[model samples]
Target: MRGRVDEKLPMDGEACVQAMMNETTMTKLRAGKKKFKRSYRLQKDRETIVYSPTRHSALPECTKRLPAEQAYDVSNILEVFLSTLTSRSSRVDREKAVGPSNCFSISYKDQTPTLDLICTNPETAQTWVRGIQHLIQSRTGETIVNKKERWISEFFHAADKNQNERLDLKEATGLLKRMNVPISSSHIKERFQEVDQNGNGDLDLEEFGQLYRQLTFRQEVEDLFNRVSSPGGTMTMQDLHRFLTQEQKVQADAETCKRIINTYEQIGDVKANDCLSLQGFTLYLESKDGDIYNHAHDQEYQDMTQPLSHYFIASSHNTYLLEDQLRGPSSKEGYIRALQKGSRFLELDCWDGEGGEPVIYHGHTLTSKVLFKEVIEAINDYAFKASPYPVFLSLENHCSVEQQRTMSAHMRRILGSQICTDSDTPDPSVLPSPHSLRGKIIIKNKKLPPDVLEDEVSDEDEAAEIEDPEVQARMQAEKEKRRKELEKKKKKIKLAKELSDLVNVSQAKHFHSFQHSQEKDMACNMSSITENKAMDLVKRQAADFINHTKRQLVKIYPAGGRVDSSNMDPHVFWAAGCQIVAMNYQTPCDQMDLNLGKFRQNGGCGYVLKPEVLRKDYLKIDTSGKIPDKYRKNLTVRVISSFQLPSPSEKSTSSADPYVKVQICGIPADCAEQRTEWKKNSGFHAVWNVAMTFPLALPELAMLRFEVKDHDSMTASDMLGQFALPVDSIQQGYRHVHLLDKRGGDISPASLFVYISLQAP
Candidate 1:
């Protein structure tokens, strides 16, 4: 069991002499020649200072060792000692010894000495200090000094908690997990190899517990023993021998260790290879901001690379976005909201909607019906006008390729022939380029190879081409026969690259990520979200104006696709304020000085917004003597919402409800009534055109809604439906409908019922 213990182990050899001389001798040692001249005068010097302490206080029994002189120069003293004593305290978690836990997070962390140590060279330092001490007291200068003997021995004796000798992997891992100190169990085995005294591969509890607290290397072990062994810091041969064998299976599996490491690392931004905290992973995903979706086709190996943008949100869900999106009917609305929040690029998918007009909505069923023009008009009429940035519309064919073509043709007609086809129709757009439209429209679809033309010449001859060597050589030299035609068969798909220059090329795909969970339960409302719904869209846009704009002026356009397929006019509302606009290009997290800890603890994602329309009716600029003829007109204001105007003090008093007045110039008194004609389209409360006095340039006035938003709308609530999903039924029969919140709330929820029947239908 033990190495051949030579009876004559101590040899007066060079190895013994070399071990004593170390940097400690040079650094901590001092020597000088006094003028003693053969040590004659030092005799008197020693007699004068003859006062001595008791034997117990003497150097040998001082019981408090000073740091040892360094072991003399060598490449590495520890490595040599380790070779002499191969005792390695390695008790790797053997999962075969254990079993798997029930749950796991996706990511993990690594918290080991290797990862944590920023020191230059640690192992070498521990060796020199311990090696010399062992030689003096323990009779052997081996640096290895483990005293553990039982794997089940208590590692933490100071604690009065549940006692277990040589803790198992689960217990150890759990301890580290709670401390947020992530590291694999395997690391402990590797570390033990450096400190094991005997060649044994394990350690007992005593050795392990001692090593955990008192095994730091500061002086030569034997020297410390000889100098002050009574006061501690010295290890006997038995202690050294015991420490090496005190190993236990703390984490019984590599996976378990890895998981613990991952959890800790994620919490502290530590790298556990792949383990990510559930919340951390969400934050990471949100940080991507759909960049994968925004990546261009020009990217290298586009097909193979999974973008950060297209993260698998759920097992049955994958969202392909060219920008801000999740591939659902809500994508368009999401994009618009992104813009409101300040995004540069917005993305949405376009499909044939009601009235055969291309409209934007994501689901297979129906949704808000709004014409393209309504969105554009709302943009124009808003308190804030839209920015020049383009909206990217990816038009797809839920219908057949032929139907797609028909829609394309119709698109060109309504868009003033700005949409054009390429290849077959060479010349693209004439007005500006469709591609130059603040954004782009891409027509995406799968294409089969075009069919090939029939062969013009036939080879009916059945003669074999082979011939004898001599005859073939002579015949081939003069064989200039008519070239045979090759049959080139290929599938063809007619693509419409029209108006591509004006808008953007609409790309296509035959792929769809998610499908209806219960197909049989879904009824057809295919036409509900179509361009025909633009009529309702117009109403929606007009309502937004009532909410945020002062324009009482009204106009009606057909409810259908006007441009990029979104319900611009009807579905969106505006907020009035000193809109926050950020410059300097800081990311969402950076600008906000977000608490990364809090962000991860709670679900967090990055966000940005692009200001489309910015209206400045609040601040008035006076251009004194600036272009005289261009100025000088009395201003007029219109009534938007329908409610009694609050008294100046009452309207201006409430914090929950905000009220303000804006002035409009260039309006006829006759048209003034047209602006205030009370109707369903008016907002909650508004005032019509009022004659003004004073330099009335900056007139003092007020406006407000008298009544609060009715909570009875579903039963009847206004603010209730603000963020709720739209109704699936747009038909003419009043039917009760219910919507549920899967998140489960103790407060008032979406259980309120509403009846919706298309008045027109």
Candidate 2:
């Protein structure tokens, strides 16, 4: 039986039980003619689904209740994927399964039988859906965020000019224009042909999704064929070898290249010649068993129980801004984008808004603000989608008393089970691992000391009166401002009490000295240091940092002087075992590129475990210009070939003759930079057989960046594409080096063939 849950009913256990007993109507739940309908009520915590048989009124139901944590999903009967056990139902059976049936199925993670129940009416069906959804939300601490399905609907609606669900070429062009994506009409026609899989002239929403996923794939395959093929559209053996070794960085010898061509022909066309075709190229990329970023080989599963500091966490500074930090508009999309890219730590600068609620934005700047509640909701919804790891919310608070209270209340209520209000460990001697806090939000903020009582200002007033007339007036004004600020601060401190309760796991504090930090038993005392200060420490007390950060968490941020949102080179700080080396995420410069690439290992789950040396208590860092081992020797990278590099712009027909630059960033003394001569008039077949050697002392912390640039005589060279990877993770021998755009997305078909080898000096 189903009815509106009365608002007057008390939320307490006895009241809920009595109400359910009096209201619930027993009905048959038939599955292939077997009835298993049962009456159920939620436990006090609303996490247990307790059920009982209506016939057994004298005896109790099973003591073990169906825990809500076991449930994977809950929805209406029509929404779930149902498999009929018997043959097709008769018309009578079909009639029983309609809206009046109110039959729903709930699958549990445990091997328990799927719960099938029948409700008396539509209200019961609705109540079941809502109740199960609420139970799942509370149990998993998940809230609905920017769902991809909803996003697709919104995107399709915007693109469907005539209000129809289908998009024509003109509508598609308009959609591209709105996204600021430049595409030629010919390219659009070709894409439409490929995307309209059913041979339809226009694309529906699903077909459009297929088009979005393969936009780069189709573009690159055609561009690559154009670059390597002859006028007759066939690539010779030499052409294939050059393209593989020089452009795509496939690490194939001439014979290996021949075999690859043969393999492609075999898979695409058995009756083909010793040549490559567009069909073969497309097949290689689209195949499920293809070598394009294979998760099996690329991802390294490591132990996640190490101390929290023993990892390089993907983090962002001023995460709300997407462009220039000072003038850019802030939106919840920033959080969504960051989390989607597997950034685990996000900084939010909260200030009291016009309303009583708190808002997030760059303080004392022209940047726009996003609602604090919205940001938290977005974070809760998306934090674990990319990586099921804990997310650290670094709060830079500047809210007033009432607003701070509102923020705490909103966070506790909206975040609900996601907010970690207390430590999981009985005695947290060391920082908890990311695995333990999965799907949880840890607040990192300052624990302000007790508010000091205001002292009598009679002595200061008397002293100010004795000064010269102008000086006395200035002193009195300054005193009044200080008094007002102090009073406001006192109020803020008092209001911060509830918020501070949520910060049980991590506390923000000023860093004094390495020894001072070690003496404290605090598992996580996060200290944010300016880039300059961190650099100074690295120069003067590198060992101290290396020692302290092994057990404690340290966040190194950009200096205040960097108003343009320029990022600090994170590798230098990373070498010293810093957990969160934050940078201005708005800037997509070399620093951000390197950051994205280094964390690309470990499945891009946003946390890369530090090397064993960094986690040790006592270890030599080897800073004295002496090679420690073969792994710490000079790395020689040979730039062989690059393929399908993006032109200056999509509209421009002229192909760019590109060259490569290799930058090795790590410990300051180990840093090296080099560049290759431009390949003249090569278009997509740019080949620079240039080799450079980078002396590496600490290879574990090193990041190798390769940038492709178009040579120009009248103006500066434009960046075509770039790829970055940690030197330690690079596979030796011949390898295919996939290229990436500035935003760290894969530039498919655009790759480099490189030879990598290490030599000891």
Candidate 3:
């Protein structure tokens, strides 16, 4: 008989059970009232209400337990959005610097009469652009990124003194001076303009705003209109009138309202405690049957629906990113305005230090420094509305691998449930998910993978092959078709999956979900957190993470990764499974190390024995032609040079064999591997060098072979010649095939070749 609707739902399981009981009680009360049951009967606590705790406990009733399911709210999600917004300038400048020709960089938005808003999230940016596109499309049937800028925002007071078309030299100078901009008057004269109306002498507020919008939207509208309308003008006076009319305002407002309504409808549909994301909102907005508010008001509308705080700015900056941006003060404001206007997937060029500390400034010469913390703080305040954190972060690492890892690690820690750095999702219930990276943040790099690069590799290897006009045209057509198909499929799939994910099967338990972040983190005694206190919390925490940073790291560079030795692990495991083979062979490491010798004590392991590509590192061994890379250099054969003395007169062409008597320098004085006194100082001539000194690229190779005849038949294979040097033998050993050179030079892997023919057998 107990019943009620649970309001302050918790994230944990207990809170969910409580909510269920309350709902059931509410249902019963309605039934009872219809039957005309006495008020006293309905008031019976024993039958209608469940106590707060068990075991005869009535104390501490105010203490509430929230499961992890209800912890994060809009504020948290907004916090993330804003945190990502502050780096807009860096994002743009970075992109522009490395972007292709005609590619633009970061820009700002003029919102209020004086303020320039910054956008950090890229998806929200694209979404905003699409929204403007939609608006323009719906009204005039035109679409463009160019026109939206002109009609969008506020004004520069002094610059548009006359208000005719744009800011003129004198007025622009006054405006720039007023803004405390540090620039030459001559420069201002060249770039600034006079915003005058009716050929007037001075520009006013409206004129300023006019210039702002012109800078923002007029051109975009014109370009878009040109594409959609005939010469007669698609946006006729009638269309203009309709767009300006209150109905269109309502239509626009309705879109926003519809978004909220549809979102709530979807939320209501979700019986489980799953959280909403921008991706979800976009889908819900698309599915509305006319105006969602109008449709929902009739039958299914519920007053207890979730708010807009359910989602944060979408982060697409980390995706489809360019490599650089070159920006200045004027460019920054336009970028901010774009974010405020709701563009998603802002583009960026990023650099990560070896320590993973990422800096956002981009330019031919970096005159400014952008700390990651500063970016986080600005984004938190500007975009997320002090709540939801950004949903994605695309990054490029122009720095060291170690730095990339560090920057990546911090991103996971900061974004929390919104995004994650590791390639997997973290479970939510775990207080701080192990490596509790945020859920939605995504990062990317510019370097192509082997597979992609392979795809790009031209089989013909000549510009002429790709440049044939017919071939080029055909290829272009194919690319366009492929692109369109990819876009169509991606959208269709995303839309379908988004709608599917929105349906909440259970009204609780979302692993690392947004709705859950709230129920888990929301405190009953939160009123004490005043604005200043909240600001302080933001500044302190943001400062802690984004301030000046420097990091150093050491790691192993996979082949072709970079040209540095920053990655090295001195630790080596001499376990049983270790095997060895000759480098510079058609098939290296096939056979095995046949014995123990003084060479083992000299530290010979397959992993450490790199080709001579490394000798240039410290020894300054700049071999004539072969280039040195981190990975190849890490394994070059070095110590062998000490023992094998090459005859300078001998021509060491890879095709021609140059035999040199080389000592295996590491042999111990007592012949460590020699078993008895008879084998006191046994030694063998090393017939090869495993260095891949030859410059040939792939699958191509060369080899060096040795002919070893047993000096003493008794000592035979007991000698170390199978792997390294041999100890005391009557005739010692023959050094017939000394060193072989190929494209690179030397038989790297720097091991050996065996030849044995027993006397009687």
Candidate 4:
């Protein structure tokens, strides 16, 4: 049977489907240094790509040992790209042997091994690449924006066991279970019968859709709509304007309401009458405009003319390791991921390698290595892809003079004009703004002494080695023994003049007392301190630390003891006006979520203008949770309902009892959390309708995190989905907060319905 494309599918999508359906024979590459010829084709349902060993293959025994057919779900694919773009060292030689143009890879979710394939020719490879890309784009669009209808369609197809375009009672019951809908079979049967308008024993796709809607109808939304609309069950422009102004706190007039009605109203008669039905109102409340994030801050609206020290820069620590610091694989893909995520500041731990080349890896560890030239090449390609702002290369140099020179040569050759050789501004007292340094790559490394004409060995790693006192003590105890055992190991490394000359605006400096830094007042010199030291400074001299950051940039990085690559709360350092709070980009946790959330503003340009209080020295910051009247805001959030939340346990047959924990993360005073009672067996449409209020001391520095968890009586609750965003960017109105999975992928059709209102405290 041939799969049929949807009538609504665009021309490109149709072509992609057509291309995918055609059987193609290609060589599949495996990590065990083995390859097998396979015949691959898209499934009839268009949901999976299945491959089988080609019968004409010479190795019949090897083909027999492999699975008869292997399939990959199209929905699970995260990305598809040319195999040459992969950063795995194991694949590098294989790709070269196979020819880069003839190789492509499909990367899937859940940490699945990437499916690498080599086509017979470059044209065939291009065809597969374009076809898969189009399908992915189509799937992503359906999941993010138009998921509700698409979700129904997917389940409808899933339940059609016989593929007769209809579902029997047994199939309908199974579908409800698969959807995680916990309801009595009697109720399901009643709904199914009602939707079976023709008195048939089975339900068609349209009938099943109606049945699903009836089963998962949202009463909370209907009640809210009834309260907001006019007496006639329809909202006119005046009614919508009133709702927007009063309930949503939006500054909207009649024309705005009319535009919204016209955009969201599905019924032509109601739209022509300049009124909104409940359906239109629901659509408008679930759109981008109704998202919790304020659309005004969606673009680059911040003042970018300020000095670089005046902005909160997104930064990454150890931007080479893909996993743990000890044994993680070092790949240029790490640099690509960080840069794509708007990390303007990146760290490179460069060490001397064989063949007069420099390598990047976690020093004094078992972590794998990648060529420094390859990392630089990746940075050059991806630096300005996400944001057109300046990128700061923080070099942790432990390389010999020759390798350092080679590294500098690679940067100059690959980066070329993008590498900022000198400061553009004449003023040496302040660094240039992000706008002024757009498309520029600034190096942050120790510079050679002015009097030194030749390469000189320096103890640059001494301070870095003793970042954690406990680790330093342990190392010191074993240092003498290790030195005796390995007499040839040296403590110092040579600093190359060429590399030092590349350090233009950002010169790495050792941090001393805040008073000493203030006296020196060099804006071009930046210092990086471990999280422990930064917290100590925040405790002892908060105001002075803020003052020091106003003049010079300070970066706070994870402590060396964090071999697991865990991150500290960045809000502490950010509150002290620290420009760069570097995080472990490889780790995904609440802290990283907060980091991404904070940088999600200002068009995600990797530079967010610091709040006025943090920038201005005169504004006194009370670290004790007390705030001035003007800075305080009363935030009220009413979590109305959640839709189609996934079960936390994949093996469990029971539906999820989901609850939302709303946390305000910022300063000590503003930090607070409130949670709703779990709705038992109601993950499909968990409604809390509970309102919680928080008095935010500093709204600008605050982030609101929404975590949805499945309640379990036997053990700890498992997280279902989570999302975090800046408090100030939250729009005041009825909004839908989309939930993201643990790895930050969109778990679309699963979202929280809420009404947000912020007022003067």
* Cα distance off (Å), candidate 3, residue 752: 87
lDDT digits (tens) for residues 406-425 of candidate 4: 99899999899888876465
TM-score of each: 0.18, 0.61, 0.20, 0.89
Best by TM-score: 4
Give the alpha-carbon lDDT of every model: 0.23, 0.64, 0.24, 0.79
**What is the TM-score of candidate 3?**
0.20
Backbone clashes, each candidate: 123, 7, 164, 0
- At residue 642, give the lDDT of candidate 3: 14
How many clashes show up in model 2?
Answer: 7
TM-score (C-alpha) between model 1 and the true structure: 0.18
lDDT of 2 by residue, 1-761 (tens): 12233334334434333343233543434434455335665433233344655544433334554334221212111121111122353111211132333444453322223445556654454455455544344323221111223334455665665656798877876665443334567887798898787786888877876665454334435666687767776676677777655654446676775666655553344315667666555444333123223333256487788778888899988788877655677876577667867788998888889868799887545678889988987786667878988889988777765787788898888788888755464445778888888788888876543452221111101011112333334456476664555344322334367676677567876677877887863766777776787888888887778777888889888765565778988988887778898866657788989888878788888999987777877665633234456556778888767756766654354567688888998777678889888876554566676788887877777888889888887788878788887876666544556777776654544667566776576
Provide the global lDDT of candidate 2 against the true structure. 0.64
lDDT: worst 10-residue window of model 3: 548-557
Candidate 1 root-mean-square deviation in Å:
34.4
| Candidate 3 residue-wise lDDT, 595-651, digit = tens | 212112112110111222221123232222232343121111211111112222222
Lowest lDDT block of 10, candidate 4: 1-10
